[model samples]
Target: MPGRFFLTDPMAAVADALNVEVGVVGNEPARRNIAPGQEIVVFDGALSRMRWGIVPVGRVNARGRPVMEQIINARSETVFDKSAFEGVGRAVIPVNGWYEWTGEKRRKTAWRIAPKGGGFLYFAAITDVWTAPGGMNVPQVAAVTCAPNGDVAPIHHRMGVLLERDDLTVWMGDDLDAAKALMLPSPEGRLEISEAGDVDWDGV
Candidate 1:
């Protein structure tokens, strides 16, 4: 899974690659360590900034109790089946790569995972709007995850559902079945994973 994401690429280049407008989220500065709850660029039909975590404000469980925790990632297997995810919109999180950790907490090693040939990785995501008190609306998103591929299985048990450039439209399309079919592991050997050194964990 992508514990953290890094999008060092320029917004203009990302817009060109996705063939979409940059929209309100203009050419912002590069971010090396994008954590959950922070605003990240999201592409539904156009690019926009959205909080990386979904706050299930009024969502209730089977017993009609409030769901207190914010969701940063949703499993692909039950994303659609869950009542909590009802009315969620489809979107994509385009990033240069993501970081994963292995071993123990303090002694853990950070691994950077990216496209082998150096492009962008589009993570399938769900979008929602959380209404804060005093009538404030916050747009939010959460990445969808599936079983890890061969390259990721050794380091992590799950990985974000990545979509091909050609399949991005389908993933954001109105057809749920077509979009669900795109939620699968990226082809093995297409990603290059290595030690993530030189990253400042304390800085953005």
Candidate 2:
């Protein structure tokens, strides 16, 4: 699973790559350990922070967590049918790299996966808004995952879905069926992996 990631590309580069303009943000530096519930960058060429977990609408529990439960990664096979992720629309999570753990559960090793050319990966993600007490709404996101390809499977069973520039329109537009058709394991040789360095977000 792609549980953590780093988005070190400067806003300008991210905006240019995504072909969108930067919006408002509090000026946070890139994060090395992007864990659950922490705000991460989203594509729209904007810097909006979302709860890392995905909580579907109409499922908020009185206990605070969503009644439906949150998912860190949405499996590609069921994303379109699962009530949690379904035809819900799309977004991009721009990242320099994502980390996957290998080895036994007790002492797993972490590996960093990036695009073969060392450029940013425009990860495919889905988003929705959940209501809080007193009608407050919170936006949340989930990264879409698929079976790992040849280069990345050594570290994990699944990898995040990625979108090339050409596919962004299908993903971000109102065409759910078309976008779902594009959700498949990326072609072999599309990714490269290496041992992660000291967990430094800025160093990427």
Candidate 3:
């Protein structure tokens, strides 16, 4: 799954491609490394910024235990069925690409994955709002993951569930079954993966 993402394209391009108004996400600068817990651009219906990790403040698991950690990615197999995910809204995370690591911790190789034809890859995501002690509402999101397609299998066992441009409405609509139907692996040959050794992880 994607632990970090990149969106070097301009916000205007993203707004134009998605055919939605940029609204409050104005004049956003290009980002090369967006990590978990960082605010990211999301299109639920209109473009907006939301924290990348879902803070399960009062959520509980199926076993009735409190969800202990923040969720950066949710498994597609149980996203809808899990007790902890109930009432979450559906959204999409549009990105230029994402980074994945392989091998051991100190010897890991970084891989950059993006759409083969050079456009945005819309990741299916779930949304929520965390109410802090002062009653401030914090919107958040988590990318949904599924079994990897042939293109990504060598690098990772799972990949984020990608959505077609035409299916964006269906994924964000109120139809549960229709949204669930779109949670499959992206087809092979749709992605291009390469070694990403030049990224300045600390600068972005």
Tens-digit lDDT string for candidate 3 (74-99): 99999999888899999999999999
lDDT per residue as tens, model 2, 130-166: 6777998887888988887778777778888888878
State every prediction's TM-score relative to the real structure: 0.97, 0.86, 0.97
Stretches off by above 4 angstroms in model 3 are: none
Better of 2 and 3 by lDDT: 3
Which segments of model 1 are wrong by more than 4 Å?
none
Task: Give candidate 2 regions above 4 Å deviation.
Answer: 45-47, 57-67, 200-204
Ranking by lDDT: 3, 1, 2
- TM-score between model 2 and native: 0.86
Top-lDDT structure, candidate number:
3
Q: For model 2, what is the error of residue 70's alpha carbon versus the real structure, in angstroms, after optimal superposition?
A: 1.6
- Model 1 over residues 1-204: C-alpha lDDT tens digits? 777999998899899998978778776789999999899999999999999999888888778888868999999999998878989999999999999999997999999999998889999999999998999999999999999999999999999999999998899998999999998998898999999998998788
Q: After superposition, how far is residue 119 of candidate 3 from its true place, in Å?
A: 0.9
User: Over all chains combined, what TM-score does candidate 1 have?
Assistant: 0.97
